[model samples]
Target: MTISGEFLAFISLALVAVIGGVLLLNLTKVVHMVVGLVFTFIAIAGIYILLSAEFLAVVQILIYSGAITIIMLFGIMLTRHNDEESDSKGGGWKKVLLFLGVLAFGAAFYIGIYNLDFGTEPAALHEKNTEQLGVALYSDFVIPFELMSVLLLVALVGAIVLSRNDGEKEGDKE
Candidate 1:
């Protein structure tokens, strides 16, 4: 029996997601982890496209892969002073726990996949593009959206406050 196009696409996407996740976890350096995160986001976008959510796929790539990842990279670069020695102490029981957690997650996912009977009927697609998303954001989800904006603003202010070198400069003035 031949696999359907949709099934093949889903399998490929799943493989990519798993591999990216593994790479992200195994990497010791912050930059490599960030690159793996980008790959994971791309794989998730591919999955979204396979599910016919084109707008969501585009938003995933634009917001998560582009904006969020860049912000994280900048944050890491600003915060880390000695990047070479930062990851040298990563070893011991943490690795064992991580391996166990991954094994458990894989077993659970396999069991769920084998047991579940996904209906073959196709879902009716919607045409809610960017304009519709904006309308919904300002209408139904207005409060939550505004709250998120406030949260991000607060985080930015906090980062600036924490990274200020006022005390360090005062010590040098003596």
Candidate 2:
């Protein structure tokens, strides 16, 4: 029944992550949603550091907080979206239904996890985790890794093409 600093850190980080997710879901503006996503990413990275996986923590910050967030911003900037608010008359019922659904889902999730037994032994995975991860990724998962890179390149090309088309259409109208 002792409270440790690690436990406090974890609780705070988890709360921040949850708040960020809620903000992301409830935000009215796209840019504000992106800010919430960044908050969630950074909080997750902090949790990773607390878990003794420094390499994973750095990767989380770099890949998610840095690269992915920047990519999202670029995507947002590339696409045009109407910012006008829509009429929401009679939306109260829909909100009530959604809230009830979420409650049911949460209850189910809690029940499922209440008596879960995942074994008692701790994994000896803290040492040289980065090196081990690199070996596994390069040797066992090389093809998938390369394929993912190719997929990303294709997405980038598609975005450029779509934006160019939009520009040409606007020019034609002028």
Candidate 3:
């Protein structure tokens, strides 16, 4: 039997998620880990699109993949004294536990999916969804959005404060 459009989209999203998760697990280097995270974010955006939340998908790509990942890479570069020495070692029972954890998670996830009763009717697409989302954000969700902005500002200020060389008085160092 031929798969429906929705089923194909779901399968594609699942494949992306699996690939991203595997990349995240196998990569030892910081940069590679970040790249895996980007893949994961992209996969999540794809899932959001499958759910018909296009605005959320775009925001997920923009914020998590674009902004946060760049910020993380910058932080890593700024903080590391020796890039070559910073790479973490790979070995031991940790890998075994990680594998087991992933196995258990997959089992549980499959069981949950098997049990859930999704409504038979599919949702109708709203032509003005973007506009409705904007209205909702500015009117109903304004306070939470403002709070998140303040939180981000605080985090940026904290990062700056932490990275500053406060003890490096120029005359004293010489």
Candidate 4:
């Protein structure tokens, strides 16, 4: 089968993203995992760009690759870790339970996906997605959008507060 350029690009990006995820899961070092995460984020952004969602692609890069990754790396570095090698791959009962859980999840996912009956009708493709997105965000979804923004702001503040080195914890008697 002759694949179009767009199809080839999508496959390449998908492979890169999958590889990054696999690497992130298997890597031992925290820093190595962060690098893999960056690859995954970039690949996802590339996919968004290919789909003509330029704003989403830029937002993905800015929020995920730039901010979240940095925050995660800092969290990892600041937290203490035992340097000893662990048998992370569990033994005996743990392994069996893990296998069973994975099997159950896979079966459920397959069944859920198989049961989906999307109709054959073509969807309306909006050409001016950015304009439509702006209008919807400002009009129809304005309350939800503002609420989400406030939620995110509160979460950020909470994270900062949690990460701060408050001297009270160091001192003794209450």
State which candidate has the highest lDDT: 2
C-alpha TM-scores of all predictions: 0.73, 0.80, 0.74, 0.74
RMSD versus native structure for model 4: 4.0
Clashes of each: 0, 0, 0, 0
- Whole-model lDDT values for every prediction: 0.85, 0.90, 0.84, 0.88
lDDT for each residue of candidate 4 in 48-67, tens digit (9 for 90 to 100): 98988888899999999999
For residue 152, model 3's alpha carbon misses the true position, in angstroms, by 2.0
- Please say which candidate is ahead in lDDT: 1 or 3: 1
Candidate 2 regions with alpha-carbon error over 4 angstroms = 1-3, 166-174
User: Which has the greatest TM-score?
Assistant: 2
C-alpha lDDT (0 to 100) for residue 81 of candidate 4: 88
lDDT order of candidates, best first? 2, 4, 1, 3
lDDT of 3: 0.84
In lDDT terms, how accurate is model 2? 0.90
lDDT-wise, the better of 3 and 4 is 4
Residue-level error in angstroms, candidate 4, position 112: 7.1
Deviation from native of the Cα of residue 60 in model 4, angstroms: 1.3
State the displacement of the C-alpha of residue 102, model 1, in Å, after optimal TM-score superposition: 2.7
User: How many angstroms is residue 41 displaced in model 1 relative to the true structure, after the best TM-score fit?
Assistant: 0.8
- lDDT per residue for candidate 2 within 1-174, as digits (tens), equals 899999999999998998899899878788899999999999999999998888989999999999999989988988798877788887899889878998899899999999999998988767888898899999999999999999999998997777575547655785
Write down the worst ten-residue block by lDDT for model 4.
165-174
Worst 10 residues of 1 by lDDT: 80-89
